[model samples]
Target chain A: MKELIVLSGKGGTGKTTIVAALAALMPDKVMADCDVDAADLHLVLNPQIRESHRFLSGIKAKVDEDACNSCGKCLKACHFKAIRIKRTARIDELACEGCGVCIHICPTKAISAKENDCGAWHISDTSYGRIVHAQLDIGEENSGKLVSLVKMQVRKQAEAQKARYILIDGPPGIGCPVIASLSGTTLALMVTEPTMSGLHDLKRIAGLTAHFKIPFCVCINKYDLNPEISGQIETWCREQHANLLGKIPFDPLVVESLVAGKSISEYDSPASDAISAIWQKLQLAFKE
Target chain B: MQIAIASGKGGTGKTTVAISLALVADKPVRLMDCDVEEPNCHLFLRPDHMESQTMYVTVPEIDLAKCDFCGKCRDICAFKAISVFGKNIMTFPELCHSCMGCFLVCPNEAIKEGKREIGVISQGSINEIETLSGTLRVGEAMSPPLIKKLRDMTSDAMLTIIDAPPGTSCPVIAATKGADFTILVTESTPFGLNDLKLAAKLMEKLGQKFGIVINKAGIGDGSVEKWCAETGYPLLLSIPFDRKLAEAYSNGIPIIKAAPELIPAFKRLLEEVTQ
Candidate 1:
């Protein structure tokens, strides 16, 4: 089985639009939304969840007020500055990684580690195929862990169902969650724009994919927005021997489809001819 | 006052606002571009001289000669960057966040610290604006560590502007974490509003007072203003969709410097944010 990940160095590059179109093209392929932080692939696929599971990425430290001696040892020991010495010591939930350093250092045994539910993942059935995705609660860290779990569940479902391919819509930027989305993928498809910053971030994310030794391809969305930059990107890809999969023209139908909560392929099949070309190139890249 | 300009979504004109605001700082301003992965504020500011410093993290290194493949380091690693099973231990350095949990918990004390250069921080002065930027090594996995380095280079000033990286992830949080106020630069589009909400959530979660600067303020809809009004958040400044400003940005020119008239608006923005 093969896995392909669609990612962008930055958001608002029409990544999900391409992913949804690819999913529509490959209706038999399993899909997973690894961009747990701001997942929108479900809006297109319209998955009906079959099973959901709580995802515990780490522990949350809770202070026991009754056992508090106000020693301030934990506050001093925490490198993250997660522990604050107020009237009583308080732990900032956002800052705490649940490293247990506070609990271990607390002389009064006032801190204890509790399981933290960072997010939830679901195995769902969509019009295209089986879908695996996660919903991360606002301000909850560990989207990376949840992304990993979602991919794992997708792989399991794909294997059980004997699917030949798994498609993942990844998060933006070169961060932990993006790294997690790249795991166990046969190829990466970077969807980028024609702006200067877009090309710059593409190079960064491309370097990351190369560092991971993942064979990747690029598709320039809105290639006509700045044809000069798009041309430069093509030449650079040629020099690097990296695949420039295809070019997606600036299409307003994309926004129309998105506003209607439908994939371009479903909304206007004729309007997505450029994206269709990208999908074909992707399929060819994998076969090669 | 140190102010951070952040947008959860990319291409939301964060660098534009940062450079423009820095250009109008009545005092000697320092600009820290914490978006190391895609540092574009420098493109606008155009620093004359740059001094670079490498940022390193300490990762666990087990002395194999000590004859201890006891797997203690592997077990203690929360990142699962290391793993030892049946006499073979594997290390994935890209996955390591360098929390030092493994080296601290090793029973045989066989683990030693090994340095991994994550990225580089560059310091320089652009025109009158003192600039510091952190650029993560292309393949390096971690970014907050590098952002932390850039933040440490800031001086106590009347106004210090930070151009934070896009997204509400670790890097953005690291950049805007301790700022006195945060200004979220966004557009009037739906995508812009969608991400602005996420960035607003981050500021609210951190208990930081913040306002919005709507770039291309009349492009698509009034969604940003609607959301801001519903949430009772102030709309600090609005930069209209000016083709001349966009053209200047494309040419690597600071908008405020190119068009001096905008300086008054930026000055007003600074005052609004500080007050």
Candidate 2:
């Protein structure tokens, strides 16, 4: 099968709205939400979780108080200053990366390594198909790892069901998590807005997808917000030889759908019709 | 004092609040745009650059001639950025977390360090406000390293404002980590409220004290204000929804310059923020 990832370099750019609509349109596809840091797909899809798995990024330094002497050597070894010399030298969970250096360098061997529960991944059953999603802890790191895990789960489920496609709702910006989402995807659908920063970020993300040699198509969300900037974006895309997928106009129904915890397809059929055209073009472009 | 204006959601006026606050501050200020991936603070601040530095990260380069592809180098990598099965050793530099495990574990000394340009660190003055900003190289994967570099360049002064990236991700954490105080700028919409809650959770977990500035306050009802009151987080200032200001911002002009009355509002904002 094929994998199609929907990403917008900037947040709140209707990336999830389009993903939701696409999911509804492509009923047989397995889905994954790779935006673990602030995952909100569950707000719309409301998948019934079937399985859950714990994710561990690294070894967190834990202070064994009984081992005695609080010499604070672990604090010195920690580059992040995660160790706090409190009453018994507590480890700040948010600051810890599970480096294990602090534990190794502790004079009294009081610091220990333990499996830190960074987040949880779920194999859920949605109306469209099976979904692999995750919820990261509020202050935890390792979203990149979690995204990878979610994708793996989706692939495993897809293989079991002989699914034809995998659609991913990706996070904004080209960071570690975004890189994880982009890797191994057959085609990337970059949803951009009609603004200067929107065009700028689309280029950044487009460059990233090209670096990986992943074929991509661009869809400008809110194309009517500024027809002038949208035209410029279309021109720039043409100059770069990138496919300019159909543009979706500025629609308030997208917001209404989000607030109602529903997909655009379910919330507004007219908006879904526009998204369907974009989806149809993507399907034809990536057809084997 | 270093003040980082951050919000978990984009287009919530983090950059606008930062630029406006810096503009109205009487004392000298330094504004650092830690949101390297999509930095728009310069669009409003109109920073005149005086220096620029290319930021680089060292990735491992395997020596083919030295040749023994022992799996030790790949085993220690927590990110799984490297893999060696038999004689085939493949390295994914983009996935590498730069832990130097591969270099230290290479018994044949086959691994060598190579520089990769990830982003650029730009230093300048925005209308006499000593500014240092980072612009991530297009297609670069990581952002925290560049953010750390920018933070390291901040001068110790009365007020050093950082325009943090949206979301409670690694880059946002890196930007607001050790700040004296954080100001979260957000709107009153449902999405804004949802993401602000995430930002609040991040600040609370980081143990950094912070207040909130409600932008486009009357667009929605007082839900944002009510949440702030319920959570005991201080509501510092409010900027009403004005089309003229949005137009000015979209055209790369400071709101205070476009509307002089905004200066007093921003001044009052800083006073409340510092208080």
Q: Which predicted model would earn the best TM-score?
A: 1
Candidate that would win on DockQ: 2
Reference-based TM-score of each model: 0.90, 0.89
On the 0 to 100 scale, the lDDT of residue A99 in model 1 is: 69
Model 2 clash pairs are A59-A98, B1-B158
User: Each candidate: fraction of true contacts kept?
Assistant: 0.23, 0.37
Off by over 4 Å in 1: A43-46, A266-271, B62-111, B242-263
Superposition-based RMSD of candidate 1 using all C-alpha atoms, in angstroms: 3.0
DockQ of each: 0.38, 0.43
User: In candidate 2 chain B, where is summed lDDT lowest over 10 consecutive residues?
Assistant: B243-252
Local distance difference test, each candidate: 0.80, 0.81
